[model samples]
Target chain A: MPKLKRTDPDERATDFVESLDRGLRLLQVFGTISGPATLSDLARAADLPRATARRILFTLAHGGFVATDGKLFALTPHVLTLSGSYLRSNQVVTVLQPVLDRIATAAQEISSLALLDGDDVVFVARSSPTRMFSAGLDIGYRLPSFCTSVGRAMLGRLDDAELAARLKAMRREAVTPQTVTDPKKLLAAIIADRAKGYSLVDREAEPHFRSISVPVRRYDGTIVAAINMGAHVDRVPKQELIERFLPLLRDGADDVKNRLL
Target chain B: MPKLKRTDPDERATDFVESLDRGLRLLQVFGTISGPATLSDLARAADLPRATARRILFTLAHGGFVATDGKLFALTPHVLTLSGSYLRSNQVVTVLQPVLDRIATAAQEISSLALLDGDDVVFVARSSPTRMFSAGLDIGYRLPSFCTSVGRAMLGRLDDAELAARLKAMRREAVTPQTVTDPKKLLAAIIADRAKGYSLVDREAEPHFRSISVPVRRYDGTIVAAINMGAHVDRVPKQELIERFLPLLRDGADDVKNRLL
Candidate 1:
């Protein structure tokens, strides 16, 4: 899980910080593996020289972002403040949590808010009625935009060229047996979603997970994010999801766009 | 919002990356605000010069960690990947997620995991089944250690001297009417928690929110983090919380420490 791409300081700006990019690269490598990594493990993962990694780790340790068990290097919980920084600054999730909660409660399902990032949809907030979907989804979990309903909902909001580029970039994988992998088919699905004003997917992301999502609009009507409610296929039939959850998702998105904004 | 504490690169290692520290300070500023910020706003919040802030923002933007609307600079959801890195590497929450889910389902309440960081307790993972207390708490939300049950449960694990140092460093603030601001009394409560094998807090951090917490231990039995179940005071009486919620919490913690680890 070593990162191959690195930011070039001299690429565009005169004062772009190279050291900072390296530091972030160091942080990036940690996500790829589980458990504490040795200095060598980190250097190899981030493609940094051992000495350079040591220096950055030390600096991060000093800054309360990294820690050591006297051998392996690991991140401290203080590093969470960084993401907290992003979440708090946006405050969209925080502002919308009560609303998300209400939606989850009313639907008796897992409701979530996800923002489009690169070719993926990153879950920024989630409200679940149970721990069923809690793994990898306590905010910051990324899912392919090609498969999940929320992903399709946001993709539906993208303009033609951007959507085309994203569709082109995606390496279409069939996450489950029901996942749509063809770019053309995915595009058609997104376009249909645009027409329908929401995206509904059945077992595309994971088997037994069914969801329907709508775009979270901005005051300017731009789709900044998407919201959805998901449940096990057994727990929710498709028609029931639309009848019970669609209005809740649409209203929640409206609340996010108009009231929270 | 500006961070005055900058890690000194020359303190022990000459190669300590100062630019990276500045870059993270750029991130620290994001936590204090509630919305998008201009370049100048970022500089003022992080205490960086306009040019320096602009450069760092450019570096971050290039790295896909930050995004811009051609005017205001803000972090992208990819920053969550950083926290995700930490969470995955530890895998504590990921491994325990199903267990937390079960706890939340069994208790019919919000179950969460928190790790101690400095004077604050940062929630690393959460399995909340309802929206009752979902606002302001996703992964990485920080609560004052003194006024929280999860904090006291971990504090209860600390040795006498470390506990004393923490109490001395704590800037006791009355978060709610029932919050114990006295250092000595807080110490006694923590000791009581240690003896009781759990911490019970009633309407201390948030108004009318009652929570009980128990320490999650490593396989070797040393407390690593704390887990809790929270409910409204009206729904859960303290006696019922201890009688009903405590056993579920202890079992959940035991499962996290022994089964997951």
Candidate 2:
């Protein structure tokens, strides 16, 4: 393996107003890890010098976008203000929330809205009862797009070349015994999902978790995101997911797309 | 009147990398008043040369953060990813969502979380079943801090000098007849809020909206935000807000603080 260069020391001496890039790069650092980070951790994650990282963090902190406990720095609830703008400005989330609420109440399971982020799926909105799951799944969580139903639903909308490129880039590590590691098999599953207009993944990402999903389209008929219903395998059988949950997922996606358009 | 000289133009200019600030400034121009902006409009808002603004807009359009229909540019949902990181990293939101949900369900009204942003209060989280008298009370929306219960709760925690400076900086225009624009009266109200550990604003921000709020503290006892319950003026009387809602608001705020800590 080639040696990985961490930071380019020479770039520090240059004076360029890359503040926009610096600010965005600072956000990307948080995506790489889950917990709060100290100044040194942020500097290393963004591949910037400590002084540079400190300046960006200070500005963000002052803007009420980020918070610090004098020791560790983390993103603040004020960030939702920005995301709230998107939720309100767009018709998708507002229309989808009620439909998702209905599905969660009906199935007594977790339902979510996810969009593709490069090769991963990022959860944008979610609804779940307090006692539904042992490990709570909140918004902003990302998961590999290879072994999930929402991933397949999104993948179903891509053309052949785009699908090939995506499969070529994915690492086919087995997350569970049921996970499909072979590119050929994954492609076949995606093709089937396209035919049915929905997808189901059974214990692929986790042993006891299963999910069913459908693609959500915009007014222009372009697939933009996905809605999925998830439950424990012991509670929901594979056939019940297809028969009972698929319609709710499809209707919710349709409702969201219709309102947004 | 003194001319408002644009502050630190050189420092602000250097804050952009390859004119990325010019690009972000173009995006910020769409907030509140201006929904969609033409090319010339964007150039003026960002104070950049027309060609510079066009180049930045072109790049942003390709990045999917902005959309254009040949004449004007509008924000796309993709832009939220930049701010979404802040929502994901904040433990406060994760703790507060359940509380907001309970309050909204219990009261059958709007429940929200807000933080002090300079002289304004910005909504961070809101749970509402329907639109009431306040039409645009969504997440990320900003309102004058002096006119809101959550704002007053947050202000009550500030030191005397800090609070006085904030009042001096605010515009003294009354939003409604009930709004307390007189500095002395407002100061007394804030003082009373501090003594009682909660705040109530009746028909101050809007004629038919009444709210009660309590300060949310961190584990170290620093007030970081406030939680509020809002109802239509006719549904919840001023006396009932203090009697029925105050204790619940305080309890909910305590629950969120405990969970976050």
Go through the candidates in order and give each one's C-alpha lDDT.
0.80, 0.69
What is candidate 2's lDDT per residue for A1-261, written digit by digit as tens? 111122222222232335656665786577565557877999998999887776676666655555666457776545545445444544455566677667776776668877775567777666653332211124446677889988888987789778977897887678898888889889888988888899889899888999999999877677778999887888888899888889888878776665554
Tens-place lDDT digits, model 2, residues B89-132: 55666678778767766666667888776678887666653332
In candidate 1, position B97 carries an lDDT of: 75
Where does candidate 1 chain B have its weakest 10-residue lDDT segment? B1-10
> TM-score for every candidate vs. truth?
0.88, 0.76
Name the top DockQ candidate: 1
Q: Which candidate number maximizes lDDT? A: 1
Q: Per-candidate DockQ versus the true complex?
A: 0.40, 0.17
**Model 1 segments more than 4 A misplaced:** A1-11, A130-136, B1-11, B129-136, B256-261
TM-score of 2: 0.76
Write candidate 1's Cα lDDT for B6-98 as tens digits. 243334768678889999999888778667677888899889888788888888888898767657566778888887788777766777777
**In order of the candidates, what TM-score does chain B achieve?**
0.90, 0.85
